[model samples]
Target: MTADRITGITLSSVTLPLKAAISDAKVLTGRQRPMTEVAFLFAEIRTADGHEGLGFSYSKRAGGRAQFAHAEEVAPDLLGEDPSDIGRLWTKLVWAGASAGRSGASTQAVAAMDVALWDLKAKRARLPLAKLLGAHRDSVRCYDTTGGFLHEPLDRVLENAAASRAAGIGGIKIKVGHPSPAVDLARVRAVRESLGDEVPLMVDANQQWDRTAAQRMGRALEEFGLTWIEEPLDAYDAEGHAALARSLDTPIASGEMLTSVAEHHELIRLGAVDVIQPDAPRIGGITQFQRLATLAEHRNLTLAPHFAMEIHVHLAAAYPHEPWVEHFDWLHPLFDERLEIRDGRIHLSDRPGLGVTLSEQARAWTVARADLREGTGT
Candidate 1:
């Protein structure tokens, strides 16, 4: 048999329109407007032996085109490389785009290719991604975030919360920081009342709070017995988060906004968060994510992966310590396979790789495309 060499790579940009505008603390603070859609950059790798693999990275509200463009520029470097050498290929793509810098859009672009390579390898091994990574469990604790976006009314939020628990989701996370601390408090109180004491609840400030507000909110929220308070302050404010973690009984979680492992290292080193929340695509890809995971595990931090549940459920399961994976329904239309959410957890499927194939709807949503072959680019 011919050795499996990457023969071609195709990148597609798909726009997933939201049923209604999505708003969170960032929008409420005037830092960003309501999000009407999400942009996904999909990388499909075709190997010499006819195997194909797919992986994606996403952007909310902006930078879709930038991620796609950056990937296009550097993807030609991937042709003829061994697909099994995912780490080395990731490094090659990073250096190919080094002039554009390494963290934000640059690494985000490389993340798609990096993930695809991993998926390809896992599929070749005929194992699900979590199994390929040596899963600690078959399922991961799950929480719902989409149902509680700040854009919805309080009643709708409550309804979503009740429905989420009914659907076997283990926990609920609501956006806090709506410009009125009192409103946030009222919402939390109502949700707590609705969900009762047994169900887990989490709140996210989305980094709208200052030190004073975070301190005040942290104290006020202690009564609720939340799972954790996420993004209580600016993501980069390690010292502030460290102090808050020390001061409050409720665990503090952040780092989802950070775009690299080195940046996450600073957050971990500062002892800023008791529960660490990292988004794999935002930080790089699975390779980079595993690096960060090792560091977090060494520190013995609670793992709560943020967003991209299809991807994160697998990563979370592979964690030795129990981990929580955020459930967001926004990306559901993009894939044919639906993750099983039962018994308050996301369970792994028997299918190989990520267990997802692009839906026709996903292909229909494509707004841009590019292709690179061993000898030519299209």
Candidate 2:
């Protein structure tokens, strides 16, 4: 008997809206904005003998419509290609448009297709994604940042940090960059006091400060002991980051906005950051992120990936030296199987293809291009 060859490819864009009420300001800048939503571009590949594979791409930003159009435009290149040769296909797709699509939105669109193909491959093998990626651990330690924005009062910030600690979270991350050094320092102090000296506390400024402001604020928080200071300066200021890292006791971490292995390599070589925080979608996909993880390992650095915990969980589980996965209690209700987080530890899933199933209700909320034309929904 001969093996079946891939015969065709199909693409669909799905959107899921948040059931929880989103606060106006949060909806604009917070993690769970009033319209906490996601748009996914799904790809399905069929084989000669009836076997099939499925893949998808998603983004939380408002420009997802453009991303969908880009994916649709690229679908033709993937049609009839061997779904089994995912690596080869990924390389070809990335190299095909090297001049025009090597990074940025183009690579992100390609990543959506690439990840979906990997999911289909895992499903066909009837194995978990971690196993497919070379599983090294069954579980990953997580740090909670569910208390986003840090707009809450000082007591409330400590309260949330204490709750995360009690939940068995290995650490806690709080938002900074409130345009107040004293206020940011006080918040970090309160959280540390509440969690005590042993529990790790991390802070993120969200790229809201310049070098002077970051250094002043970072130095003040150093006494409290932070796991790392994330994105203190602009995401693109590698030299500034290197300077800040040298000046501070807490490790400087950035790179969530970085888009390619080349960029990551430069940041690493520059000694710009001690920790690499790659967002799966932003970094082109698991393939590129995995390659970056290897580079981090070789350099004796930590891999603390950014959001999209569902995908990060699998990636963390596969890499032996992965430091910790950020846990933001968003995106759970949209998927059928939520990533299991127990007492700050994220347990890996045995389900195939990232173990996420899109609900019909969620899918129905998706804002298609036609929907935009009708102007009926967001």
Candidate 3:
């Protein structure tokens, strides 16, 4: 029997509150909000066979309503379309939004749709997402980004790193680029001391520093043996990133804020970063992420996806190169199940599709929603 055609789509806006008010370098410097507000647009694609595939895309804050609206605006385009032809559907959506530019919030909204379509396709094939995408491994290594905020006291910073070490996490990333570079250096030193010299340590400046600041601070911080320094320069400043990369022995990792593989390719072509961190929710979902991952692999660059570890775990496992998934448990409340982490790596589930769905707790946080069916008009 032929697989069912697409029938309807549903979108919802969910708000995720941070466990605590966490601050990054940008936030501490008053460049960003002190509290993290996670706004996600959840999407569900229904088929004529009575199957539904779930997906979501998130914003740092306040954009979930718009994302949901955009998804609702585009949902009808998939009515009666083949869910398996995700690539073609993705192209159609992109072209439909071409007049409004091909990236940013619009593309992010498209990501919610693209992800759900992939989930539906994999479910129809009766294979887990990783296997459907071609599994390279059953698990991939993970690093904790939860403990690495700039607002915590130095002792607490060290304690966080120590806790992650105690939990068997492979590595930890700390926020950097404080007003006093000395403060940033001291925190890193303390964390490294607590975790010991052998444990992998990474730092994220969150694109707060200029080329000169990056050069000065990067040189000073080199004594501590870090795995990489992330986003020291702005995401679009490929030349500046290249210069900083050349100046420091520490690998510079970036691309989380970038919207497309084409943007990532520009960074890669400029030799800007050693590790590329693509956030699928921001980069138009798995289809675009796979393209970027392939490009990173071909260039011998490391793959360390930005966030949403639950999803990245499978994608990271499928990559030819060893990939690192950032662990941020703040959003864990949204999922029905917890990811299985063992020996510093996250194991992919064999369950069909993404193997996870919205939790009741997540439903409690829903603020707005939209439903689209075959007869609906944008």
Candidate 4:
């Protein structure tokens, strides 16, 4: 066997083009063009034994380069360290960035590294990431966020939901927080009317509203029986979320913007959200996500992982409780493999690691690349 130590790390930035601009309440409210570019930061951790593990993080519009730089900055700390020691490496990276990046971009960078480390561990064990993490289920229910953007026409939105349902997807979520509560409500109502009562429907406001608006809109939209209302207000408004949670029947799902497991604990301890939506890459990757998942299970909260479905599908499947994964096809070009979504549920593959590898399409999109060796750069 080769040295079990991590020898180097390679990084790349993939510029993904959206088929069309995608808008949500925040885009409409802020008057910014719906984001048309997705920046994907990829990390490939190489061990002395010639095995490599793949991990990635993404920015909706910017910061992909910054994340790659941060990952490079942390690479030295991982040199000669066992890839199986995921926890130690994660802590090391977190502490290294604590002064400058206790959260946000630094944490996002850590996510890419952490995921690569986990993939290494799973591959060494010759088991899939889910099984390595202790599989709670082979699949998880899924909901599509693709069709329900604020910019789509009502008919298109309805058709999107109908198409998703007809495909056997379990549920669909649309964007809310349009300028007018009535406008947002009308869209929700229209989807409800189209889908009828049986299918699950969710709405994401992208934190575009204030407490007053969230409360009012949450109340007004309550009639349609939403599975949950996502980010009705700002993500950090714990007290506001608690109050709204108490007032509404729909569960409040948040935490995607939060960058640490400790932050998730604060959100849950405060009764801030009924369903926790943590993004693995936004946090510190798989290790931190497992911590959050354990916390959610013990706290009796539902787990609904935020995007990067390719990575999250495995994590959600390993969650101790029933979990949901958001469906977004924007990253399809980045990976050679993807988890399957059938009959509205996502099934994880048994292949070792995260079950995905960078695709040639991803290679074509690479605007920058680097290979950092153990003793070459400091």
Candidate 5:
């Protein structure tokens, strides 16, 4: 039987305050400010046959106000398309913004709808997303990536690391670049000392350093045994990233800013990064990521996706060397099915589609935030 076509698309915005403030101590770019909360643009797509899918677009900056605008503007373009023909739909949307540049905000907007289509397709197939994508393993490994210097004290950071390790987490990621390389080095060394040798430790500077500083600091911290260094330079600096990758012994990982497979291809061909971290919300959704993963596989590299652990957990489970999924702990309160991570492995649910549903209370709570509706416009 032919799959039902996409008949309608709806978009909405929500803001949720973080349990604690997230600060980038390693202010590599803009002035470091305390982030009040996260904002998301959630899209729901419905097909002619009544199957539906859900996807979200979010940002730590501006709480997703601009992203929501992009989604609202693009929704009409997706009306009446075949949900099953995700590739075709993605191409149309990518071309919709061809005159203006298909990569950044436009691509992020397309990713939201594309992900919704994939979710809808999985639900229509009556299969979990990982199964629909072709599951390579039953459970995927995950690492905690939420211990920020702004909220968690040094003692608390160690405590969280210990708790995660004891809980059977296979890896941990710490935030760095609060401006002092020495402090960053100390923090990473402490975590490594605490976790010992078995559990992998990753660090994200959040685009906090220039090439020279990143190389200098990265080399200093290399002795601590980091699994990878993420976003050390600006996300857009492919050549800088390549230089840093060549300079360091630890793997260089970036690409949360990437929006298409072409960019990934260039980065791979240039040997810009060792590990590729594509955010499903930023990179034209799951279909493009699958294609990128295939390319990375052929190049003898690993796929370590960034953010949205709910979605990445499924994608990671379907790959051969997708070692770790980033665990930010932001989506737990919003969804009914909080992922289960036992012994560092994320176990997928048997429920149809993505197996995530927003709680009524959460929806109401999100709607009640009037301040977020004002839109910070970052």
Candidate 6:
């Protein structure tokens, strides 16, 4: 038997429309407008052995076009490469677009490719990605975010939290950091009361606050007993986050925006956070995520990946520590499968790889696409 090689690759740029314009702290703070859609880069890899794998990366509000463009530019480099060599291939793609640098859109573009290779390997082994990576559990604790954006009225936000709790979601996280401090406090109080006690609850400031504001909100928020206060300061402000962590009884959580392992290391090294929320797609995909996971585990920190429940569920399941997965149903329309949520957890299925297949609806949503074969692409 001979090792198989990748025979072809396909990439699609998908525009997924949000049901309504959604706003968060960034929008309220005037940094970005409400987001009406998300851009996705989906990569499908086929090997000579006829095994296929699918992976995708996404951007919201901005950078979707950049992600697809960069993936298209560097995707041909994977032709004829061994699909099982995920790490080396990741390094290969990074250097292929070295001039564009190693993080942000550059790495984000290739994240789909890195993810596809991992999926391919797991499918070949007939195991789910979590088992392929050595799962610590079959089901991961999950929380819902779709219902709690800053744009929703307090009543609507409370309704969302109530619905999620009834649906077996283990936790609820609501947005804070409105320009009006009183408004922020009121919403948190409302949801906390609606949820009652015993359910894990958290809040995200989305990095909209200065140190003074973060401290004020953090102290005021103490009575609710949150699981964590997320992104209370700018994501890269490791020193500031460390200070906030020390000052607050509520654990500080940040790092979803850091684009590389090196950037996340600053958080780990400074003891900046009690919970580290790394998004696999926004970083460099699973290879980079695994590296960050190990670093976080060593620090005895809680692991809670930011979003993409489909991807994060598997990664969280594989973590040695019990970790939480953000459950957002926004991407539900793109895939043929749905994650099983029961008993306040996201359960993994036995299906090989990521346990997902793209839907016809996904194809209908594609705006641009390409195919690459040995020595040729179209």
lDDT of 3 by residue, 254-371 (tens): 9999988889999999899999999998888988888888899989999999888867887888899888999887877898887877788888888898888899999999988877
> What is candidate 6's lDDT per residue for 71-102, written digit by digit as tens?
99999888888898999999999999999999
Q: Write the per-residue lDDT of candidate 1 for residues 174-194, one digit (tens) a residue.
A: 999989999999999999999
> lDDT of each prediction vs. the true structure?
0.92, 0.74, 0.86, 0.87, 0.77, 0.92
Residues 1-378 of candidate 4 have per-residue lDDT tens digits of 544888888888889999999888768777566799988888899988888999998887778888878877776788888888889888998898777667788988888888999898888888989899889899899999998888899999999888888776899999988887788888888889888888899999999989998888888888898899999878888889989999899899999888888888888988889999999998878888888888899988989999888888888888888989998888888888867779889888888989888889999989988788888754
Q: Any residue pairs clashing in model 4, and if so which?
A: 168-344, 169-344, 170-344
For model 1, state the Cα shift of residue 343 in Å: 0.9
Model 5, span 187-255: residue lDDT tens: 887888888887788888888788888988888888887889988988778889888888889999988
Q: Is candidate 3 or candidate 6 better by lDDT?
A: 6
User: Where is model 3 poorest over a 10-residue stretch in terms of lDDT?
Assistant: 369-378
Between candidates 3 and 4, the one scoring higher on TM-score is 3
List residue ranges in candidate 3 displaced over 4 A: 1-3
TM-scores of all predicted structures: 0.99, 0.87, 0.97, 0.96, 0.90, 0.99
RMSD in Å for all candidates: 0.9, 5.0, 1.3, 1.5, 4.6, 0.8
Clashes of each: 0, 9, 0, 3, 8, 0
Q: List the residue pairs that clash in candidate 2.
A: 15-366, 22-34, 27-33, 27-34, 55-116, 167-343, 168-343, 169-343, 169-344
Pairs in steric clash, model 1: none
> Global CA lDDT of candidate 1, please?
0.92
Candidate 2 per-residue lDDT, tens place, 106-188, comes to 78777777777777778778888889988888888899877645556677777777777777778888888764567777777
